[model samples]
Target: MTFVHWLAGQAGQTFASACVMTILVLMLFMAMKLYKSYRRNQTHLVLIIVLPLIIIQNGVLISLSDPEWSASPYLHIGYSFVSLLSFIIINFVFMKLYTGPASRLKGMPFFLMAIGLVVVTAAQIAYKPEMLSGPIAPGGVDLLALDFYGLILNFIILLNLRGVDQRINYQTSLIVYFVYQLSDMADSYVFHGEKPMLLIFIHLLPIVYYTLLFLLLFEWVLERLMMTFQSSITDGLTSLYNRRHFNKKAEQLLRDMKRIAIIFCDIDNFKKLNDTQGHHKADNVLKQVAEIIKEETAGIGTAGRYGGEELLGLIAAPGVKPEDVAEAIRSRVEKETMVTISVGVSISREGTSIAEIVSQADEAMYQSKTTGKNKVTLHPSVSQKRPRSESEGSKRSKQA
Candidate 1:
């Protein structure tokens, strides 16, 4: 056999293999999605699973049908219709899942659909009946029309991706799939009947596309799990570490540090304020106090919401006094919010446990509350005759 004949046979076999592989992978993906949807009771996953099945059918029909039959205008039109309809359905499903019905489309999808319709109609009008007598040829007007149709379908899919949550996966998969379709369309024209080497490479595009999509999906699932773990440790009301996380992290900090400080802060008259100003205003005050604490303790330590109307700060920096950190936070809360915070400082020494440090700070904070509403106090063991900073004294006098 001539080289051309051998090359053609190899190309044909490769194309067949590629089609089979794509179908199998797609079916597996569909089954996976189906199981997930069933477990989660989410009906929306049905559309994505079904759409791929339709595309798989199209691929199978194209691979097995006679070239002349596939090239016929009626079959060509039917293929385009089925492919376009699948994209439309899948696009709607994605848009509904991500953006909701309110912003599903602002006319872009419909406009693209109209454009695709015009291209297909124009292709049918420009078709020559005489061309049917010859073997399948490249660059026909009908092929151009189909290419345009596929392009519009891809554009619609991309449009659905707008406003999707960035952390969620599948954005990359959608883009890869779009590029794969376009490359496949272009390859049909570029490698038709000759160039077996290039055709073999083109045939591998689906494998690459699906593999990348699988990897991206795995990454997305991992990200979601991480986010869930973070949320568990975080305080939803203030976006700070919760008491549970604070306990765990403070223990870790103490293990690595020779000197550490714990500052406990309680909002003064918070219950009265909540009763008078309402829960909404009380929430705002809590959020503002949390922000102040976060800013003051950043880098020097970790801060968290210990409980209602109370916040905790842990500072492990050498040469840093717990009183100074407490005063900084007390001053900021007084200046920034309508309410005042009483802060208590406790210094960690050799063989001191985290529980002991927290207890000392809490007692000191209670002393501030009992003596005066908005003052910073230190546990008697760590208290010294050191004069308070001028700024801290001034802020306290203003509160007085």
Candidate 2:
């Protein structure tokens, strides 16, 4: 068989492989997202997988097609421009959506500069459609322009990866794009040379790139897996560690046999806040409350989203008393949320279990809740009285 025929066959196979891997990986991610029951960001992940499939498939088609200058060169050029532009634009949107708007500042300029490269490539294709049929001389303007354009695009892909927060995603994308560019350059050269080994090498190029892409995709799957695991132990709306992690950590703290303090806090009339401001505003308020809680107890203590409208923090400081931590948090939360927190504290002496400590803490919380609100309650041993009147308790619950 001719070199061109062999190389073309390899290109076709590479494109097919990439398509297969993309479909499989995307389906796997979709399954993960569904299993985890996360409602947000699933669509974004789908777009990320689908957009590349389009670009890679188009590339393979262009590589295999025979060029005819007399035919609609303009149409082919337009198609090329659309393909490249679409890939870049979709990638930009994906980056921004996932990483936030600030990340776009760094990537948008790079993409804007790429506009010139796209224009040049399209112009080249339209002016000389025959160049599209086969590889160009390395030293020629057409090849030079295309190579330069590729360099810019590759650089932008890398730069965008760098700005992302997800470490595995960034590294995997970098590796995949790096190998892909290498295979792309090698394919160009093999097309020109047409040697027997080069034909085989050309066929193998897509396999390498596709394999790397698949690996990157698996990294994404792994990341999503990690996120799902993390979410189970985290508050869905506020992103703080959930009650499960809190309970586990509290148990560990108990086993350490050190004097530990537990603080239970309830957002004062959060139901009223939700009713007055609407759920969206209430969500923002919850996030703000979580942030303040996280900021305050960050290194010294462990905070957990103890179900709705409540949070728990465990401070393992033998020197600090339960009342002090409760007071500090209550004051700060009141200031930030413009709403009070009825805080309850329970301190466990050495050798106490987490369940016992929690039971004591919860009883204290109920006391605070019954006695109006906004006030702090200490463990029965530390404070005067525990129970409040049933009528008062019923009234407070009704008001809330």
Candidate 3:
């Protein structure tokens, strides 16, 4: 019966390693995809090398644990040592990534990990741990001494990685890894080969550890993909939808809504500001004006950077007057920033497409720019009167 239980334990170990091999292979594919997407990313580059090595190491373990012959004790020891080194490699690379994107790490952590690996290996060689071959059985502390040393070294690595981004939630994976290591060290001792119910933990814990790490990696990849998508659609300077994407969204809204409005805004004397104040100051003022436009258009509509110092807002909501929103944007820009903006509001009538409506708004904005610098104008096709209720809110801003 004792011999049967030991054989079962050995088989379970092989099964656990097989499950981890599948997870490592999946991780490798994701890493390769990430590297292909971002050639400059350091984390993805290291993962491409590390994951394949880890996968090969796992395969070596599975090959050595051949069920029929049970392999040699020395063979298992050699496989275990290689697996331990893989752990060190994986942890070191990821710790740097999670800390920050900057190259501020300066390799101190790598030095620490390398030194720990050397010391641990030297001690294991000198101590010559008995039965480094199979499940550790209940005995003197010396039997599990090397494992405890490795665990302590892992804890030190965790300390170095303490400032990881909390949003990533890596702590959960760390907890699982700790349990897997502890179970591996206490495997035969705790189960004693009789308690089969609890005995499965020794095999299953390794799989759980790998699965958690894989989930964390998947989440990281998802975040990078989302960021890439956002950058493609938005203006890098203003953080507003760029002209192309804005046009796409506006057309979609025009198709669904019975009536929509476009407000075109052009900054007054923007080139003069750029000439006198320098590009940096001009940029600051432009950002301030953009902020005002964004705030006024929030909820009722969306704003976009049309081009240069021009901006556009599209209102799709019913019962919302476009002329009033334009006046509010003009008033706020004049009051809150170093300069003013000339705005024009145009509403869609039956035959108008997004292009036609925007063209009408642009003509009205040109009217305001030519007649006087800082005010709002409504397209000739729409009523020119301001809503009386909102006029008091914008009374301080001069009109053309």
Candidate 4:
């Protein structure tokens, strides 16, 4: 029995050493990453976990020096407790920032956690005044109670985010956090002393799973940030380039001296539709119509909703006549759906300003509305007399 106990202690020391090395390496990597992106939230999160781990390393080393301290068993459990607390606090802060809402608990849990940590820290101090002299008090009820409470609270915080559809990355992190704790707990109590080799191997399960999960969460957060950056330049409802993006696109076209066609479209009686259909159905219709126009102009131009019922498209094809592009939009608007729309087409080869082009298209669209609706009118510069000989121009002009 003594021989087996000696062997187990030896393996525990090795495992503790490996964890310490891993902690050092992670800290170095995190510090380097922080130097590159000072404001990165991830750098801050890594730091939060790292701080607790550093404290844990000190505790582990002390416990290791005096095997009589029972540090072998408590080393993993102690750090896991601290880690679980830190993770919960960090995750809660993230949730509040993301949703911009105060946490529901009114700070009671936080108070309890602080008290528990204080009790544990004081217990550690009593157990070891000096690393040179290993002394352990049989881990009283208060000590065990504090550790168990931390674990339960961590689990509660995890469960709270389950049904909420916010910060999916954080939610995933919480799940990984829970799994890691569960596995660590299992290996510690059930497998640690019985089979040192198997316990060491099983210990790696949580680490690998958590490492992979953490990487995936990093990717997800990065992707979300990119999406938010892109969304700032886009319209929320129509998924079209917003006025800001349109201005930027126009400026680029002007710089390149590219010929462009600007078409303005307004849902012919949109106000009436909204009044009749109610806001909900009206919103659906607007989305549907916007999608139709988007599909029609796919690959040919950039389409955007210019707020409310107004939609705009910018087509840049240097030699392709502006009037021809306008005609295409006009034809698509007519045949695409049963919903009627008045379209104004303006083609500019002179590298004109976006404002001037939009004004011209707006004027033409209004003219279409005044002249009995549901048709396309080309800008006055592009043979605006309705093709005196082509009657289809005049024929479809009255369909609206």
After superposition on all C-alphas, the RMSD of every candidate to the true structure, in Å, is 5.7, 9.6, 4.2, 7.6
Best by TM-score: 3
Q: How do all the candidates rank in terms of lDDT, highest first?
A: 3, 1, 2, 4
Q: Can you list the residue pairs that collide in candidate 2? A: none
lDDT of 1 by residue, 1-400 (tens): 7654443454454465556456546645654664574465343355546546565654644443445554455555556566565555544544444454554444456556756666675665467555445544433324566666677666756655656544245566567657756665665666553565554444555455455544544454566568788899999989899998998899898888867898899998999888988999999999999988888889889899999999998898887777777888887777778888888888888998888999998998888888766877888878665323335454454442
| lDDT (tens digit, per residue) of candidate 2 on 1-400 | 7755655554544555556455545645544564355564554554555555555645544443434321443444444455456546545544543464564435546467557766788677677768656543332223445555656675767655655555465556546545555555565554553444554554455455445445544555677679778887888898888877888887776677466778887887899989998999888877877777777676667788888888887887666665766766766666566566677788886566777887788778877887877667888865676532223322333233
Candidate 1 segments whose C-alpha is farther than 4 A from its true place: 1-44, 51-147, 159-161, 165-191, 384-400
Task: Give the poorly placed runs of model 4, Cα more than 4 Å off.
Answer: 1-210, 318-328, 331-338, 384-400
Q: Which candidate number has the best lDDT? A: 3
Model 1, C-alpha of 27: deviation from truth (Å):
10
Better of 3 and 4 by TM-score: 3
**Collision count of model 2:** 0
The true-versus-predicted C-alpha distance at residue 365 of model 3, in Å, is 1.2
Where's the lowest-lDDT run of ten residues in candidate 2? Answer: 389-398
Candidate 3 residue-wise lDDT at 165: 61
Estimated TM-score per prediction? 0.72, 0.53, 0.85, 0.59
Candidate 4 structure, TM-score to reference: 0.59
Error of 2 at 309 (Å): 1.2
Worst 10 residues of 4 by lDDT: 134-143
